[model samples]
Target: MSGIFKKIESLVEKGKEAHAKTWHNWAGNIVLEPELIFHPKSLNDLQEIVKKAKKHGKKIRCVSEGHSWSTLSVTKDYLVIVRDMHQIQVEKSEKYGWTITAEAGATIKQMDDKLRQHKPPLSFDSMTVLSSVRASGIVATGSHGAKCAGASISDQVVKLQIVTGDGELHVFSDENDPKEMSAARINLGLLGIMYKITWHVQPLFKLRMIDFQPPIKSWLYPATLKEFVEKSDSVEVFYWPFNESELDRNDDKLWVKQWLRTDDPITTSQAELGMERVCEDLETRFGDKLYQFIVKCPESTPYITNLLWKAGPVSKPQNVVIPAPDAIHYQSGIDNILCDDLEFTFKADKDFANVAEEFNHIVDSVYAYAKKGKFPMNLAAEMRILKASPSLLASGYDEDPNAIYCFIEVLAIRHTSGFEEFSAELATRWMKKYKARPHWAKAWEHVPGIKPYLREILGKRLETFESVRVKYDADKIFFDNKSLEEVFYGSPKSTFTESHL
Candidate 1:
């Protein structure tokens, strides 16, 4: 046991911290102190530790930036911190095009910066979490944007090198095997520790942005869905809470924005100011009065931006072009704003009407609670579109190759005080009513019936995933956490007990 610690110490002599406090999650809600925290410098070092941990029957949890809104990364046993596994190497391929191999620990921003060095460059549509923190190889779940044509980062992965629970290294790709490819893409950190990933990249391009605010009454309802589908490359709607009577009569507004591939040069100053101005307008329109009232306002920027649309006639679109990486998405000023959870999707099939009804039910229910003073002070719903991909776990499941993604975010101002309770209840309702599944990385728990719902919705794909899991993780080496067990194995209680190495 002491030898295991010594080996880890040798690899990460400086970053290691003993008796360290359990890390806080991205939402700042849950924290757990692992028995030991090890940062392995190389894949070999990781394999060494995995070998020892398996021999001694120790449970392991691999952590990245700890940006998950859920407890998936929490562990009380052996925790592998892979922040030092950062490396970016690109190679040109004549057959499959450009292949970029990166260590899982590299941040998305770092990868984007490196890709820009190419002649034509390469780019990803969105980023997960903040760029400063080291991102885990898993892409840290639930980090997606509103590009219907784009897939989650995991979907871009072409190959991966993972260390199985027994410390055996397996290089998986589509050409070598299909089972390995499916499981490796979503791995859920359950197969083993992912060491390296290779992804397919497109030559760099610019993204054009046009921001508009439109009245909620004019846009979000069933009537506008068709027009929304045809008019934009990517469209998102955000709603705010104000006097319901006033809003119903045309007071509340919606912010709509679109992004398309373009040939324009990047606009750094305009992008920054656009975000700041959006924030400022939100603060100005709502004022501190709403915040003090503890009223859950629609995220100020989106709502205010929407109001701006109603203030004038819709005209020629305003255009702003920036580097694809920089222009991909914006962090609405709620940096401190924490969500109980978020769920969005890429597929809206026959289930669209049913899902829409369920969504409206939840919204109406929340509003009813607010009217009764039973609602928390912060919460908002957002809707967006996405194009489907091959990744099994991707939200854009198989409705259409290109489908709209809708997001409903329940933000919590105070962690305690009914916010958590309400959000949990709402999640359960969503699962029961819409057969909805929560994002793996967001704030959601595996309720009793969730697995069956997933199986029913995902059909044979779910069975295929299980078959793949059985092949890669016959012993369940990566099933160390309760949440993960619930997600993969449908266990109401975890069977694997924690053992120290």
Candidate 2:
């Protein structure tokens, strides 16, 4: 009825390939040419587009930045892009801490910068997929911070405003009318378009980071991971792969310990110079060609440290406060390099041996695949721990208070080179053996029987999620894409069923 809706309709009817090709994901993995891409500027504009699509019976799906490694955001129908809705409003609260409200399109960097302006600034410890934060809301998949005691970005949500499939807007929060806040926290774009989210902030605190290299097996076993967390405010491990010969064993891993403390001003000039020195040494020893090759792979891969070990080990300790937001999320050098390329996450039980066994299984599988000419060398896996949340489809699922998040990263290469099949197989085997749940934003598909598998394992929780979906989305207008449907409901045709069978 509105002029904007009419213009959107004209664009969809045109069905131009040029329009379709313009949409690309962060890793450049999925290139979708949607029939219509809606760039709505306001909540009203979004509602009109959705209403028209529902009325016209056009299959539609919403996409953020396509930062997800999976094909979840890809669709041939109408693809909603939420980039223009970047508005942030900060308010001081007397009872609770500060509350910051932001549109879905605002980047994590933007949120962090804005929050810093207030006294006793609050920190959100979650890492974000590069370029992916622009097109989606912050709470969609419950993005997490790295601190063991820290909560995911979703947990910080105090309020949310979502536009339902039928173009009805709903507001929910703890203080206001509560309607399944857990389920709403990580809705996977299946519930509705989240227009705005408000986060409760903590007082600003400085984090002291101590970086040390230790043998992963000895220093970062299951027990060690728990102990490290208990000892420090936050702990993260980075395992580097050995050279091409011994990819199974990690040469050295970087362990960073961050603790809350008063500001102790220190100059970063020395740390920056050290990093530069290390980089220069690497360049000299490995040569530019090999150094470039190493930079292409994810930092979690065991191969990275192998090259470093071959060159030489750091003689002295390194200490520095993360200067910028990106510095904290993106580690220096190889860690930062690989993040721009690929990302994946899996949820597993909190058993260290179980986790270690799975890592070994994947490593062994990579070796076996390499022998058969099916493995790719340009990838890495990061291991992180998270506490379970009440969200239905959350990776942590049902478990003890805490769970582990293993993020696997691989370099993005041309699909024709068999990397796609290799990655798929890797994901399949991991899920099959470990019963791992893939990250919503990362690359993965719900194979056949996964729904049933989840139903069996998760039991009533799965049923509750389905019931909520049925109540909220009867016609499935919100779930226009296959991936969303598969994740929330069931997949009619699943590769898991045939492959597993």
Candidate 3:
């Protein structure tokens, strides 16, 4: 520590109390024990910690709720908790619509609750199902909602207040250096710490949930698939897996949730989304006896996939109208199911770009792995469409000029044997075939050649990210983990110091 920053030790000790302990993300994925943890209540306090970290040659990271699935926020040297910096401001303008300014520590749930109090009420465009994540974290990792127009959380951020490595406060917006702004929109927590965020919110809206069951045999009818996406504001397709013999009987089915904004004033929905409600709709769709059997023998999942898609009191509510948030988010079911997922975006060949072919390929991949004795996927493969973004490193952006992007993800329960291998194999194939970029907020460390892949696909965009990264964090104080350095900077694992020292 003595060879690092000269006055860092003293500066860190000045503004806040520090502790040493082990920390893990909300998903229990990354667990690391840092040398020191500081709780910063104000901007000045955070500045002092950053100054100290720079002076002492200590790596630093900031965590509020630690909801990230990636290891982006883990640090072995120092960690700053900015949870106490939660503050929010609201403003209205006819041109930009409603703008909400909130500190990095603010949560989506908190913002959503506050936005609902507006005259017309306001809601964010894209959001994760779980509302507990910090607002800045959402943008930092490029989290996306099921909506097509908004794309990802970064799309909603209009401005950012950042504290760089030099302990200086800088504000960024689209009007200021559009390239840097694009890079900063999805910071990856590398450029700097997000102190505050300003988001462009939409007026209060209601969404009608339509639960429709499409037979597995014809779910991907070309015309029907096009209408499914074009008619709905947001669409989520739950492709349920089934046994081979069931395909012979043509009993398999796909469950679909199509959400569209409505002016309707009614709110009566059934089959809340989560494992707790697993049987809430299933039991009614099929007889209780069969439902119980599928529950017990998960391998028999195909028998009930269609029944759940059948309109009923559960997900198939006829005319349910709920607030934007209710219709936008559903339970993640993470609490009950110890699951892991492999999510990536890609544009299929033009001739095979439709959902049916995509699903066929996905099914083919699953069966390929299954034939090789890879473990069967437990939960249904969750699929969603994403729009392209101008952000430099936006993973969902289609690299091809006219190509469209869609997110394909598969969940494997922790209890399942070979869960890790199964996911890794699938991710490997997706990246190899599609040149996919793994989601920043998910378990993506194992993706093959992800670093070189990103470097190749991103091309100059990677350079732009590095240039801005160095501009904001020249000393690399934010490079908390060796994995990030290895991937982003092509640093050798043996020595983290190549240029700084």
Residue 295, candidate 3: Cα error in Å is 14
The residue pairs in collision within model 1 are 121-204, 148-386, 148-387, 240-298, 254-306, 296-377, 346-395, 346-396, 384-405, 385-405
Residue-wise C-alpha lDDT for candidate 2, range 1-501, written one tens digit per residue: 699998997766453212444587656667877777877778887787778778888655676655566566666777778877789888877755688888878876677777776666665544442323641444676566566555456776777788876788877676653446666777777777878887776655555667677665566556665566566655555433454335544443443435434377654655674676567556544443444554454433344445544453344455665433433444323322322223334564455655555555545555566556443544344555555565666765544445555544444333324455555665566667666666666555534355444444555666666666666566777676665554445543333554563
The residue-by-residue lDDT of candidate 3 on 1-501, one tens digit each, is 675675775565744765547777765667888888877777887787788788889988878787666778888788877777788888986767789999988877788888988777888876787777788777888888887555678877888989999999998888888878988998788877788999998887888877765665776665666667767888787665553333332554566788888887756544443442474335433443444454456555444544533423235344467778866765433344335666877764433345466665666665565556453564567777767766777877644434446777877554455556666666666666666777777777765556555656676787888898899898889987665766676722322121211
Q: Please give the distance, in angstroms, between residue 478's alpha carbon in candidate 3 and its true position after superposition.
A: 0.7
* Candidate 2: segments with Cα more than 4 A from true spot: 1-21, 125-132, 135-138, 176-179, 243-263, 266-317, 322-327, 332-351, 360-375, 399-434, 446-452, 455-459, 487-501
Better of 1 and 2 by lDDT: 1
TM-scores vs. true structure, each candidate: 0.79, 0.78, 0.83
lDDT of 3: 0.70
Candidate 1 yields a Cα-based lDDT of: 0.61
**Better-scoring candidate (lDDT), 2 or 3:** 3
Q: Which stretch of 10 consecutive residues in model 2 shows the poorest summed lDDT?
A: 332-341
Model 3 residue 134 CA deviation (Å) reads 1.7
**For residues 225-298, what per-residue lDDT tens digits would candidate 1 score against the true structure?**
54564556565655444323322324554456677777766766755757654874465345434343343443
